[model samples]
Target: MTYTVNCSILLTELPLLERPAAAKTAGFDAVEFWWPFETSVPTDVEVARFENAIADAGVQLTGLNFNAGDMPGGDRGLLSWPAHSTEFQDNIDVVAGIGERLGCKAFNALYGNRIDGESAERQDALGAENLAKAAAGVARIGGTVLLESVSGAPNYPLLKARDALDVIARVRTESGAENIRFLADFYHLAVNGEDIAAVIEKHAQDFGHIQIADSPGRGAPGTGQLPLGEWIARSRALGYEGYIGLEYKEPAETAFSWAIRA
Candidate 1:
């Protein structure tokens, strides 16, 4: 598999509008992000500006996330949150618009963590409903809904490979469509105590998108314990053919070095 830089995590030192170009200069042909704007409801002009940036930069947008509120502030996701259901729905068209415009084929729909007083069943129902809508929209463009796991926050519900796959199964059943698939982020899985090798052997076919970072520090590969190159080989060995998103923290200048594993 080749590499696609996740601009949201890498090149943090550059302006948002410039990250795609930076990724390109770093030798990446594709990139991903977690909602580039504070609100998923960016104006048409704003969206157009981003589109132009990518065009001018000459990089393919591989994936994007639905608005998840404040990622750095511990907001796990928006769709599954009862209060943010409308917000999540409102962002769907905007997301799909950009995806269609950019020819991006992957979308990550995070399952919101539990609200203080809300029941899991209620939130879960909302997640299913919202994801069904999202799946239908992306399916129009032949894109896939990525069920991903997040780590570094205890409240985030989907932290394991099985956790993400279970949610994917539930969404598929509810939507009655097969456009949804697993987004296997190796860093999160390892930190959550999953055996990466075993997960790959069993669920490789379910993975529509894959991301990586070394665990323990969520830093550049050499700064952590994961044998990312070996695991990537394991993934390819099992019939997985997809871009591996470089999702980790590193100096923008040195970030591309980790792509050696790709």
Candidate 2:
């Protein structure tokens, strides 16, 4: 089993480029992140800075997210948001370029929250179209595109495991690319009231990536009530062979061994 830290959430005390090394300091060989910069269009210099960070830190960029507008302000993803379609297009190559340089093979395309005044049907249509479009580029790069659920945000379309699986199926059909897959974040599923084992028992094959954060507080495994170790064991038993992303609030003391071994 491989465990990858999510720098966008953990090790955030450092600059964007510096976070990779911080993850390494915490004993992680693989790291993933949200779009490092705010803009969908960052200059070549900025892109290079990010590339060098990962290289110098000696860690792999296992997974990445395409630009999703202002993440802190609740812009979950741009692919589905109509106002950001041009920005999303402008960002595809930039993101793909980063993945190519790192030899990373997974990309997470967040389906954005609903926009005001736009009908849900139209937004859903736009989301499917954009998902298909992103799928083509990701496939060309020999990588799989991921769709994940977010917690507490009803406006975000992919809030449930079933919801994400639906989009995965639609994107595969819409693009004729079977490379699309589900990103199963157990914390989000638990937050949304889905039974984890049931999701795995039924659709384990649909999950391309899995992330864990204990429920009640989205903290490290030992700090909460979630049976993450058990869940991880179950997922492996179900034949989930993907990376387990460590995406949660940093504990007061960064403990690394158990998470990796689990």
Candidate 3:
């Protein structure tokens, strides 16, 4: 099985720019990341430095997240938020530029948490619109836009494979953008009470990318009760031939021990 390190969550012991090289040295040829910049439109120099870090490290950036506003501050994403619509739209080119430069084709777009005053119906509509725009932005490279179901954020709406797929279907029907797809992150799904085996059996082919950590503590595979190796095997058996992102939270030094054991 091919694995890609998620530098944003794992490898936190090192500076952001250094994680790609660290991951490369740790025996991974591919990596993925959440938005690394503080702003949606970072200076060109900043973008170059980020691009160069991955290039210098000789690791392929297999997947990336479009700027989901203030992740550390609890902003899940900008897609459905009315106030941040411009910010989200402004980010599309920058994201596409990075993807173009690094040969990364999969872009994950987090659906924003539901606002207190905003109607759920309106938010869903806005999210679909922004997702279509994102789909169009990366269409030049034949790239895919990913929608994910997240856990732990109480206000965030997407909590199941069906939820994400519903948005994807809306994007396809409303905008005629065929490039949007589901990002199947097993840890979040399991935490949200999804049946991993059933999801794999039914929608494995619909997944544009896959991310994993064990459930409960969201630690390395062995730290939780999830049968990660078996789940991965089932996904592959169902024809999921893509990078499985190692997006767990654990000390970097010991993170890959589970892989060694497997």
Candidate 4:
């Protein structure tokens, strides 16, 4: 029943070193972030600084996500598109190597969104093929990638847990990459009106890391509709051994910055 904080909250305010420091202040022993390689790009010295922060704060690096563009006008789905390009494989290998060196075993491989004029089945096949390639690349470096689901109901079509699982199954069947798994996010699950606890229990075998934030506002634990603590307890009860990632927005005030309940 341990927890980790996402570095996205303090990214703009704190530098890399200070981000872990803040997490420790907030009573977390580990932290995760969304693609820190560029924004908080870690040089050798900077990586050393981050290592010191982890040691000083007694925090571990939970997971790190590679950038997948889902911004407006960008077609960001990784598996939903072709992934065999030499460029894509090279990028995955490079980042995955970095992740392994940093002692981070888990990374998020987000399939951004479905591109226009692509049939549903076509996108699914493309996404699976690309993801399997990326998974193979990541597995070579002793790291695992989590296929995250995004639900863009009012926008482009999103990938659900079932879709992510399907991709995982396909990769296992076709390429047999053992490292790739699922990053079950509560916020996105709630957005799609899925059963949070049930999903965790049913898909525990495929899950590598888990993330949480209350529904509706996507704010801190108790501020919104989702029963975060209950869900956490269920995961724990189901024998989840990975870190629970807190990927949520903080209140405007600094005082509420790291406040977490349950």
For each candidate, the alpha-carbon lDDT, in order, equals: 0.87, 0.84, 0.94, 0.68
The digit string of per-residue lDDT tens for model 1 on 197-250 reads: 999989887789889888788888878889888888888888889999989988
Residue 251 displacement in candidate 3 (angstroms): 0.6
- Model 3: per-residue Cα lDDT over 1-262, one tens digit each: 7999999999999999999999989888999999999999999999999999999999999998999998988999999999999999999999999999999999999999999999999999999999999999999987999999999999999999999999999999999999998899999999999998999999987789889998789999889899888888888888889999999999988989888776
The ten-residue window of minimal lDDT in model 1 covers: 253-262
Estimate the TM-score for candidate 2.
0.95
Each candidate structure's TM-score, on Cα atoms with residue i matched to residue i, is 0.96, 0.95, 0.98, 0.81
Q: Model 2 residue 148 lDDT?
A: 89
Cα lDDT of candidate 2 equals: 0.84
Tens-digit per-residue lDDT, 86-120, candidate 2: 88988888888888889988899889898889888
RMSD of 4: 3.6
Predictions ranked by lDDT, top down? 3, 1, 2, 4
Off by over 4 Å in 3: none
Lowest lDDT sum, 10 consecutive residues, model 3, at 253-262
Pairwise TM-score winner, candidates 3 and 4:
3
Tell me the lDDT of model 1 at 75.
Answer: 90
